[model samples]
Target: MSAFLRSCRRIFWALAAFSGMSNLLMLTGSFFMLQVYDRVLPGRSIPTLIALMALATVLYLFQGGLDLVRSRISGRVGRYLDEKLSIRVFDALVRMPLKTRADGDGLQPLRDLDQVRGFLSGGGPTALFDLPWMPIYLGVCFLFHFWIGVTALVGAVVLVGITMLTETRTRGPARASSRLAVSRSALAIEGRRNAEVLQAMGMRRQAALRWREVNVKYLAANERASDVANGLGGISKVFRSILQSLVLAVGAVLVINQESTAGIIIAGSILTARALAPVELAIANWKGFVAARQSGQRLDQLLKILPCEEERLALPAPGETLVVEHLYVGAPNAERPTLSEVSFALRRGQAVGIIGPSGSGKSTLARALVGVWPSVRGRIRLDNAALEHWASDALGRHIGYLPQDVELFEGSIAANIARFDVHATAAAVLEASRAAGAHDLILSLPDAYSTKIGEGGMTLSAGQRQRIGLARAFYGKPFLVVLDEPSSNLDSEGEEALTQAILNVRCRGGIVVVVAHRPKALEGVDHVLVLGDGRVQSFGKREEVLNRVLRNPVPLKVVAEGPGGGR
Candidate 1:
């Protein structure tokens, strides 16, 4: 939250103003009592008493007005702060290394992010709010009465100690619970995400079991923590009751001796309880505070990641090349590299087709080329310099990457393709869509490109969605276009359409790289890089690689040209 400290000034002052109003209001109540006792009872005059009561009511109204103003200012500023924080978090995730972004087994790190964010959002603010109250409460108490203030001060210490102890004991359990909950949440999300797959495979029962396992563990940990908190609650009540009884008893004895007035006793008791309120809240939310702190720490860690030099480059001004040399990437705690000693180069107007079977690291290689996998060894040069030397903003402008799964937003097709970049004009959008073979399909829709696509493009056919994905890739006419299985689910007609779009990119003098298992889709490509066992098996002209593979009986198939392209 240190990152947010600068903005805290606005929020803090707003809260300070509100807190001051609250204290003033409380003091007003005591002052009204003081007036009633000193004047109203001594002189039983109705007009005088009514006038004084009216003045007290005005004071309360003023305090309430101040409180309303403070709340308005603080609430608005707090929302802005939250937006800033969320933006920073999203930018960090986008810039983080591919490995760091993923949990394990090559899933999107976004899944983990969503889980962590859910846990943090609900439980993160307690500590921050609690910290602010500490000084504010103490300052008010000290101003009220030093002797009572000292007692309040001691109570604060005791309250903090109890909270700390609860946090110390419950922190581990809370963390375990949050993690389990996240796991279950992820599974539940996955279950829904792949509901069709689960239904097809008749694995609904298995999915249910997996979900139950995680949730049961989560629920058990929650119960255990709840029991501990309940025990602490009982003990805290007994202790507080005893302390309050002693204070009241002492005040009564002092009153009997005429050392203190009934008014003083009442004010002192109320002050003590008010001072203790924050402490009680702190203890009650000890686990929540810890959870929030951990979340903030995690958030901070994520935000502090320094982007590599590649992510800092300016956009390519046309005529750029995408190059790689002796690239290698290994998984954490695994000796076997995912992409081993892989190397290739692609210049403007060049098309390089990368073919590999499942689990052969094609996706990893594609990500490395985009500078998303930064932990890999070896060189990745864009234009004439290291890819790492370019800023992400620059590289992003010049490189368009299309993953196997196209994640479309819940917006119009044109909006999704343009990513809501206000600069993208209608003509530009149409050009991109036509070039991607998505224009025909989009124009057939009632609203054309303006038609809304449901979440993840659920409303569009797989082929149509893939076309939209391709259109998104071409929206900026990026120098390098990386397509991972662009035609995986396309029919013959869709494949032909996709092939034409690829050729269109090549004709535009842009570098096109297709990561594919079905090499037949890469017909007429200039080059082919075949990967096996995480290493490059062949790197040369498509014909040369095919010849070598055929001679070695390595199962080669010639790419067949689509309609309109000569065979």
Candidate 2:
């Protein structure tokens, strides 16, 4: 975050310089009023008045030009901050869920970044830059006359107090509203994701009720924040006008005392208004300023908590073996390890099927094998290197995974089969599809491989998505393939294709790890691992482990009734 901030440091300095010039030019109006009232009007010099008007017009034009430049630069600075921080923020968004159970919405960081960027780019920064010039305005007022200067000073103090009051009153409500907004967003996202379930199970009304409950709270908080900031802002505006009129009244009194001229009345009023403009602007924008501050602080903290991965030396791709030693795995933020004291090894051309009763950690081991779940106490190594040693993208290229849900992204069949790689080749896509036994099925579609699957591949049937997901796992002939419940949605034909896909991976000397409850999914595997109560019950050649696990007579639903299903 600091590095990104430094990237825009020079721009901020430049903006400040522009702001200084622009604020100084603002006095052109006040000076014009003084000359018009005292010199031109009193002397009855028509030519002098025309010349004065021309010079004032030129100065005002310059001031307007300066203002336009400052605004343009301010907007650019906001965009610059976004350009610098977007990648890091996105990386955090992706990794946060896997690392922790917090960040319920998983999008607050993005919202925060947007808030900060919007505020930085808007007119808010302009008020901030012009704020420091208030003193200069006050100093000029003092030069006008003692009484006039005193009146402006008192008004300035009162406006500052109002700004402070706005800040104090709005802080809690602003923060509350931000939190409620996240909750509302999270609810909306989850509701949409499960829209089918809600509709099918007659939960639509209940879901709507739940949403309304959250939205009402958010609206209340938001309304409270707006009421405070806007109410105080209106007060500030009315008070500023009053102070301007009062300055005129004071200047008039001084004129009767022969201490100042009539010109001082108008000049003093103009100076007072100019001096307090920033405070009025600040009051109006206080809510956004607080929100931006809070969001920026959260974004900074998120980046620090989940720092970017450092570059690691590139290691040669592993094709030798996979080893897990004393592995203990758990769900994200779980209190206890789901798979404890679990260890296994597999070599090239080997296919191992993991079978277990429900809650026995078979899926947990599968996730750990694919580097999705962090091990609590153990190491998973590919060849001689720890799994964590390889960069994530590089590691992903060599490893393929299909989880239980079969989440196929939105794209064409060929794109999903190639894992959406921009450089994916036609031959590779065809080969992976053929290897997964999905090539023929794909050809049957109206557009074949070019068919677009709607979001989450909802247009495809469950079995179709599963087959495509398998093809994706086979893309690039990755060295390690792990599938959880690969045949859960498959018919007999799909099951046969899944078995053959496993065989194909083994034939290519790639290691395959299958987590299955169905007996048919283990038909193509060379070895079997049996787990119970998160502990390894037996693991060895298929017949041996199956015979041993069957001896328990537990009637495990996770594996075949007989040894390797009587193979």
The TM-score leader among the candidates is 2
lDDT of 1 by residue, 376-400 (tens): 5888887767876776666677788
lDDT of each: 0.69, 0.88
Q: Kindly report which residue stretches of model 2 are placed more than 4 angstroms away from their true locations once superposed.
A: 554-567
| Alpha-carbon TM-score of each model against the true structure | 0.80, 0.96
Q: Write the per-residue lDDT of candidate 2 for residues 159-186, one digit (tens) a residue.
A: 9999999999999999989998988888
Error of 1 at 175 (Å): 2.1
Cα RMSD, model 1: 5.4
